[model samples]
Target chain A: MNDIVLNVSNIGKHFGGLQALENVNLQIEAGKTHAIIGPNGAGKSTLLNVCVGRIKPDTGSVKFLGDNLTGRKPHEINQLGVARVFQTPEIFPELTLLRNVMVPAFAKREGAFKLNAFRKVDNEAEVRDEAEHILEDVGLKEQMNGLAGSLSRGDKRRLELAMCLIQHPKLLLLDEPTAGMSRHDTNRTIDLLRLIKERGMTKVIIEHDMHVVFSLADHISVLAQGQIIVEGSPDMVRGNARVQEAYLGGAHV
Target chain B: MAQLWHRNDLLLMGVFTLAVLAMPLWLAPFGAGYPDLLQKLAIYGIFAIGFNILFGLTGYLSFGHAAFLGVGSYAAVWSFKLFTMNVLPAVLFGTLLAGVFAALIGFISLRRSGIYFSILTLAFAQMSYNLAYSVLTPITNGETGLQLTQSDPRIIDRLYVEATSGLPSTELFGLKMSGYPGFYFCAAILIIAFFFSVRIFNSPFGVKLLAIKSNQTRMGYTGYNTRPYLLVAFVISGMYAGLAGSLLAVTDPLAGAERMQWTASGEVVLMTILGGAGTLIGPLLGAGLIKYFENVFSAYNEAVLHQIFAMLPDWLQSAMVFVVNPFVGEGWHLTLGALFVLIVIFLPGGIMEGIRRLSSLVRRIIARSRRDGLQAA
Candidate 1:
């Protein structure tokens, strides 16, 4: 129980008549990369959304570090040290890269609400330095002043990762972090994830890319049709027959 | 970056202050040096600045801001009637009352966003307008509106001096709030409002508001409570509108229900958008331009047109008036409408975009000339 950073038990959700998720259970271990992979319309995203408090589940609850997060607000959950990187890189497109990173840092430092209307954001030297350092770590230091909206797809994803990293989250959730990246960028991201893994931060990555999953995940959960088909070490999941059948039945993810 | 940004902001503020203080001199050539027009420019400038905080930054459009203005006006007049002839208390009370009212309205309106929020604000303002016009006639003074009357208990003013010759006007200490002194007073408040807006634009709170505008979903997951930031912005802007309305009452003590009318609310929206929503100085420019058009341009008649086209032949002059008549005088809205359409289509950033384009064009020209000179050498 101490080793489990996030616990999802019997999370069931439906949209109208369509059963998106039913009797779902997941537990992410501390200091390990857990990958949730499934085919399209498998309710993979819905399950992720439920965990993040974006969608309220029909049944059961989500617990983070033994605290109930089932019906809590998204920001409330985030302030509890959970950060999400969206598939399409939901970022402040108009803000500069540095400002984008600093925003999340402020959120972490100031909590859910701070009446900091008089103090200059630039004057927050501690947060600014961390943001700059993180941008440098992500190899975006040269273009830190450029608007995030003008970034390439891969760069935007990288910026989003930097934004999350600045929060120093206990549980980092990445939704297809390399969704629109080129092969070269994907490989680069894999190396970056490997570096993050070395830091011992627990991460839950939702990915369709097997290369990414195999390269980064220590633990793998094979979700098919809103249910986990196989859950074990990466090697065991790779050899599981149910997982193979689940993938082969559809255009393989 | 902080030092450089601060210096740039300071320079802008300095220039703005100089421009505002010297308005009478600079505007004299254009026949807008008059006190009444100058006061309007300053008051409306403050209104636009506040409106931009909500609409431009957070992308929340409240179509009932003029209701706050009306609230401010009524509060200021009541202060004058009960407390003293001093403008200080009236201004403070007006702003405070407007802020409290905004807190109530924003709490409800902010529950919805986008067009729903705009509609909710509009409905609230209209309700306030009708109530003040009819239902709350005793307090609001109904169709006659709230005005200074000799028979009323002046309270503080009465204690100082017994008996009044006629109706007493508003004042600041001993300084009369009319003509040039009134313009200066409004200008000072406008400057203070502009400075606070500058601080807000630079603050973390401001960034969060922008984040809310850019991607609210991301802000939620980033752990920023968006509603409180939005409500604060709403109250601040509401206070700004209230201040503008109070200044109106200060210069000419009258608080009519028309101040809360939807058209007044719509006018502020036009000012903010017409200038540039997000930019610091843009809304002020928009307010000045709209106010100029409304006051100066609308004052033009066929007589003024004849004066302008006097160098031409009689027939040509008459023909010119016929062509130009619709765009000036009573048809100033036609001119304003055409200008607004052109601005929305061509320069969506309002006048600021045009300034930026011009400055960049000049910079390119200078850079090319310098490069050519270097090559020649």
Candidate 2:
């Protein structure tokens, strides 16, 4: 078996009286694309949040690469090589696309904080070159100097991906990376994911698109009512009656 | 090639710096009145520029930044009283103390951003002011304020130098460097501060600060601890404020609790917003504008107006007076208030943004004319 990178056991999270995620247990190995699929309130986002240390689970233990990730700050987890992409494509709007990619790269270089007051940013050709390379890899070399806000939604998502990729994260958690994209853009995103997978990145993706789930996920977990209803390979989960009834609405082949 | 250095911005700043540096020499013919006003303008400009970094870039509108300035002033004063009066140590102590104070306030206040953060900083500043006023009377000297007394022994006071009749000799190496020298010293420090701010503005840290301002939650999820970044920014800005405060005290060795008031804190924000929050030169312009109005306009009394009125016809003069009364006469604050409102409504980005728009418009017109000529050919 591959080394277990993440181990979540008996996780429960509640908002006042309403349970968001309950009795959730999952294990993900290195270099695996783990997909979490669920209905509206199936706790996919909540689970990702708990894993990244964005929100503390009421009752759970999250161990990431042998380190306790539960209740740690998001940046701390990120420092340990975990990065996230927001659903809405959160990016620095005023900065150029290249500058956006350079931020995390700079942070990683400077070690969380740096005071290079006298040194001009342009003088750091190494950092700039790395950012440009990542931008090229994300197919944004032409629009390197374009303001991030002016980019199309799909391009913005790509820019966000490039920003995270620059950090060289051990685990990349993506929240709806293809949300609101047309078929063309969606396919491009899937292609980008394939590229990422080819590079041997361990990824956990929360996706509503069954196409995205079936296409890339090594292991699929169907969540319903804050609990996992089924967990298996795509073929096994596709045949599960409970997953079809509760998640796929009996439409799965 | 796409140029990294913003050519137009650099040219404008260069021109502006030259103009400011030459003003004292120009005003030398007029018997030394202009340099004093110019120096005050530069000093406050430093204060406003620091305030702009926190409020403008980070979107953390601090209503209590004056407290850091006050802390700096007190630290500078104490340094002069106890240690060597070499000015360098005083400035360093002031900046360091301000950083320490900012770290404490930033840790607590940064936990809650927006209006709550503003209120928390304001509360801490108010507490500081009250403490300086009464609780720390021995150190702060209460209402009388900090001053160099005759009883105080000076280790490096340079008492051998001949002092001017009214002015105490703030000397360095047996040379009288108080009035003009003090102004020059402050100017040099302001230049350094400007350079530091510009570097930070262009760096990745600045980009991160803007990202935090835009969407902190997004930054958090993207592997940034927004709190630490914000706290660091706050401390840096506070240190800048402290440097400004230390400079003020160095120019005239006095520190008062009133310098730490909430109203004074608000003044720096006003200067930044009125000048141009995000722009480098905007804060300087805002400070210059406010200080100019305060010093020059306030000095224009009825006697100064009467001299001008004597040259015009009685009826015409009365009309002119009436027209200027709301803005320049007794209603000076009304003028300030109106100016503030107009800037907020019309020029929301401040004077620097206005200049940018005007220049861009001019460029477009020039480009169009050139294209038209080419098309005619």
Candidate 3:
């Protein structure tokens, strides 16, 4: 409990008459990869959204490093070191890849607001080099100068990861990061995630891919119908009758 | 690489300065080389360029920017009435007041985005226009507009001049601003504004704006409180409009409520989109084109057309005048509208896109010719 980086307690949300999330409690410890697995329309994304302050829970709260984030704006929560990667890669398509990486770096350094209008972008030598370096780590250095909109699906995800890495964020929330990757690209992403895991930055990955959940998650939570039905280590979750029911129904279990 | 970027920026600024300064000579053939028309070109050029910073970079689409321009001119005239007849105080006060107004309006309007934001700005600008025309007649001087008065207690002017019988125009140092001198004055400010815009386009703050336009969600999640950035851009652009408005008064010495009408605000929009929204020089080109149509083309009539066709036979001359009847003089708007439609259809990026395509085609032709020449050698 003391080492928990994120604590979502009694979170509940509803859209119109439909329940999107219901009483979901999740705890992510520092320096660990926590994976939440669920079938389609299982409220996994809603849970992540609540944690990142994108959704105001009808009931309950989220705390990040002992700071309340429930009522804060998304950007304010991000300034406190929580970065979210969207289910779809949300990137500045009009800007160059290096600029995309550099934008976040500026926000992280300058905070919520700074009228640094006079300083030339190219003259921010330190930030530029760091952006290039991160692109190198992600194997995107070769395309740093190209527009980000032109990147392949796999490369866009990598670029998103590089964007987060530059922020040096305390907690990274990833929504379906490998949702549409091929097997080769998926494995490459898994290796890349493993490389990041060594740096001890906490991550909460909402995924549908069982292989990815089994490979990297130190802890796993299985969500069903807007509730966390089962949770444990990968081995325990793999064997659990409830998780199998949640994933493939009663017949599969 | 940094040095190269700076050099390129410098080269652009240099070319822009030269082109603007040489307008008088080049525009002479088109019959727009006179001081009044040249000054209008420089003035509106500043207005469009400033509007581009907001609508172009951030994609905010402020429909009330003309309010800032109008506010600037009003403030400049007031400055001339109260403080000094000098151009410095008027320009500074005009720009500063417009910036202040922008911050206040942007704070409210930026709360929404897209069409909603545009509506909010439009509503605000219309309110200002109505208020200036009807409610705040005392300040705006209403239909007659804010004008310099013979009895105005201009502190600096009072200190310098002992005899004040005739109405005096705005001045810089001892150089009277009329005719060619006024055009030069406006041209100087336009150049400075262009340089400022070039710097902004290359700044980190500028990139943040583009990111906002591209993906506001990503920018917010990336830890930027986007409101501040938006507000800054709004104020800066507003300041630019104000400076332009002030230049208008500095040359001609009047600020009218007509300048704040919604149509005026819409004109700046047309200029930006017609020229090229995001490019550095596009707005200026758009402004020049629109202003030329409004001034020069609007002056032509049946007599002018007949004069142009005089060399032809009598029937042919009559035919030419009849054919050209609706596109000039009072029908200038038709000509501008047709041009706008054509530009939008053929060159979605406006005139800048056309220029780019033309240049690339030229380059390809040259490259092919050089290849053939090398093979022959």
Report the lDDT tens digits of candidate 2 across residue range B1-377. 11546565377567766756665776556443465676787778889888878887789988899999999999988777665456888889999999999999999999898999999999999999999999999999999998766545555553543323443534444454477777777777777788678878876677778878876776765666677788888999999999889877887788999999998898898899999998888998899888878765666666666677879998888777667766665567677788999999999999988999999999999999999999999
Q: Scored by Cα lDDT, where does model 3 land?
A: 0.91
Q: What DockQ does each candidate score versus the true complex, computed on alpha carbons?
A: 0.86, 0.48, 0.83
lDDT (0-100) at residue B198 of candidate 2?
84
Tens-digit lDDT string for candidate 3 (A186-221): 998888889889988899998877778778899998
Distance from true position, residue A42, model 2, in Å?
1.1
**How well does candidate 1 score on lDDT at residue B358?**
98
Candidate 1's displacement at residue B19, Å, is 1.1
lDDT of 3 by residue, B1-377 (tens): 88988898888888888988999999999999899999999999999999999988999999999899999999999999997888989999999999999999999999999999999999999999999999999999999999988888888777877636888877888788898988999999999998899888888888888899999998888888898899999999999999999998898789998898889999999999999999988999999999988998899999989999999999999988998989999999999999999999999899999999999999999999999999999
Comparing 1 and 2 on TM-score, the stronger one: 1
Error of 2 at A21 (Å): 2.0
TM-score of chain B of each: 0.98, 0.90, 0.97
Best by TM-score: 1
What TM-score, over all chains together, does every model reach? 0.98, 0.92, 0.97
Q: Kindly report which residue pairs in candidate 1 clash with one another.
A: none
Q: Report the number of the highest-DockQ candidate.
A: 1
